[model samples]
Target: MKQKIAVLGPGSWGTALAQVLVENGHETILWGKNPAQVKEINEQHTNHHYLPDLILPTELKATISLEEAIKDADALLFVIPTKAIREVAHQVAAIVENQPYIIHASKGLEQISHKRISEVLAEEIPEDKRKEIIVLSGPSHAEEVAVHDITTITAASPELDAATYVQELFMNEYFRIYTNDDVIGVELGAALKNIIALGAGAMVGLGFGDNAKAAIMTRGLAEISRLGVALGANPLTFIGLSGVGDLIVTCTSVHSRNWRTGQLLGQGKKLEEILNNMGMIVEGVSTTKAALELSKQLGVEMPITEAIHSVLYEGKDIKIAAKDIMLRDGRIENEFS
Candidate 1:
């Protein structure tokens, strides 16, 4: 079952996924806007800027032209940042002729509309040109996946066939795929956990112990589930790989850009300075704004999200934000009550 797959965006995640596809014996083309990076991947079999010190598979191809990547491809996998999704999808929609399975691994809600990535994709890509959209998400990191470290993730779609197809498409000895029907839950869990990761990193930056981290993570899950359920997601899905699993990895791992960004903020660095230096997308920063807006509209009380939003956007001191969360009116542990 060798298929032609186009992986859009040549960042660490996209390159790692493209390598997996090539190893799986598929024709994988990685597309990037930067000609220099595309040339480096095509000629050197390495993406040094994103996955430094890791050489990509020799079979993995890179391209600068979107039309070249999409032409005759059986599937398109998008791994770009949230902000770029609609623009990229629009371009893809204009070029793609044959029906292909549309898949996305990027995590975050649309900042203004609070739309899920799949929702945004569906809006842009006509149904005639693609099958049901599948979302690949879980606790895996690009750096670890690049080195063949054992990783498991979920491919979720309302159409079971699409999910199962993606499951078989990416599964290998080191990378495992599970299928779930709860796309809403899966996407939300993937996006919202980055917010908690920021809080986790901030806790470390503030010199707090494990107790603080544990408290935030525990309560963070509560609010995440609360908001997710309010938005029509299955409550049980929150305990699965995309929910609790993603939360654990992103919040605790040093490889998480959101966590690192929060750590810098905790260390008293300004957001603009940290973002300018990081050279990667800190999705949690934008997700925080979207989550805050959702919580307000839905009347969901998400203290951790609100606190992080204050610190990141409102210029509130991290310590004071932490104090504010701690001093909120005590309620029962169950947020659904």
Candidate 2:
């Protein structure tokens, strides 16, 4: 059955998902803060800055007003940045009269509190105004998904029905959704992979061959799962799409802002300079800080995350950090076994 869905955060990811919703014959309203961009989406059906080469669906409407976007929506999909999730949820709580199914596609951790996106939403939004939160994540990129490239992702929720409901809402010939209950593993996998991607990009920047990059990705997965399992996530989820799959794509793809940031850093560029030029958020940079802090608190060793954190925030030389990561004491490969 068709329903009204409000997609918040009119960035590339949000806009791409809105295009899919429009194709699915749903009443999709995309909300953003920029009046000019909203006007362009409503009028020209194009978001030149984010998805420059793709034309948006004419049937998909957009607005700058938050109340107008969610007043009558059946579901609310959030694709905003991690830092903005709490603030936006608070704004939604203030005006929303009806309870809408909440779904999020953002991939990062809260910096100071070290909370996941769902935790942030649950804390900010009153229970009466929202249903169980669902997180959608995997290897899918907005640029590829916008042009009908085949993509598979996991829709995870503690409630089985909620995950299934989200699966049905997003599934299509080009887009496949699988339901998983390992919300913790899925969310951590998505956020933590960005840290590895940054390291992978640094490897490339240092002119390392494929072997070095593969080692970074492999070891990166080990530590990510270590910290994740310590926090009560399913160990097996690390091998799934959200884990190894996301790590590979984000690390290798030119589309990943995190990898690109690392690449520039490896080339001896400054963080401030790279961020100013990218025009998009590098999630791994922020996630590295959060992951490093969380790892220390949890007593889990995350060498790559620590290295990236040092390179990004602690003024450590990128090459020296990479060398330090390699020269660290070796351990049994199959610690999980």
Candidate 3:
């Protein structure tokens, strides 16, 4: 029952996922654009650039060549960031004609296009042949996952069979997988929570403790729910693992890039300087821009998202922005409820 999985974009998340597949007795080929990293992974089975201390399992093979990595794989896990997914998808499309069902673990929409990762995949891959697209997402982080820690994630697809199959493919003792039909909601929640996570990070940076974080998380759910409902996602889906569940974990975890990025901002570091030094992918940085545009197009009231956008892009001071939000005219509670 071994699966041939080609994990593309071998970053920390991608490397961790490849590790999981290998540990699960699956044939995994992990590919990266960096030749040095790929060579090291193939030879040493260690991604020194990312997970420096952890040794990759012997079953995992790393490659720099796209053709060699995905040639005979049964599935492709799109683990790249939103900004890089399109180009990688295009490259994969060119190399593989009869390909495996592409599974994406990325968690952001395109900033300029504001398209979901799935939509970006569809645009890159050929449409004539039917493709089974499944998304694996939740609150799991790469660091914990790499260490073989127990974690729960949700698998979603429009097709029930696809979702179930992905669940079977990824489920294991340390890693648990759940199935859901709420693709739109799952995708939206995955992408949007990062922005809110940034907000939560800012709260942490400002030394605002549990009460502020709790308020931000609850209100952030409201923001996601409003926008998600407007975009045709189920209102209640916001309560699921991909929604409020995912939000709670990402906003609070120090491992979160969005939160970390916001932390620097909260500590009065410039966005450009923080981003330049962060090294790893901070998704909420770009996701904030995408959500800002999406909110405008959809006419959703995303106050937190809007505030974060202002701070990140418009150079609005966080202190002033926070004060402005607090000073807004009082409104009836549970208006959406």
lDDT of 3 at 324: 79
The lowest-lDDT stretch of 10 consecutive residues in candidate 1 is 328-337
| 1 or 3, greater by lDDT | 1
Clashing pairs in 1: none
RMSD of each: 0.8, 1.0, 1.3
Whole-model lDDT per candidate: 0.93, 0.92, 0.87
Q: Candidate 3, clashing residue pairs?
A: none
Tens-digit per-residue lDDT, 1-337, candidate 3 = 8888899989988999889888888999988888888889888879877887789898789888898988878888999988999998888888885658889999998978998999889889876433688889998888899998998889989888888888888788888989988888999999999999999999888888999899889989999999889888998889988998899889988888888998888999999999889888888889888888888898777888888989999999998877777787777769962
lDDT of 2 by residue, 1-337 (tens): 8989999999999999999989999999999999999999999999999999999888999999999999989999999999999999999999999999999999999999999999999998989998889999999889999999999999999999999999999899999999999999999999999999988988999999899998999989999899999999998999999999899889999899998888889999999999999998888889999999999998998888888898889999998998898788878888741
Worst 10 residues of 3 by lDDT: 125-134
lDDT of 1 by residue, 121-171 (tens): 999999998888999999998999989999999999999999999998999
Ranking by lDDT: 1, 2, 3
The TM-score values for the models, in the order shown, are: 0.99, 0.99, 0.97
Please estimate how well model 3 matches the true structure, expressed as its whole-model Cα lDDT: 0.87
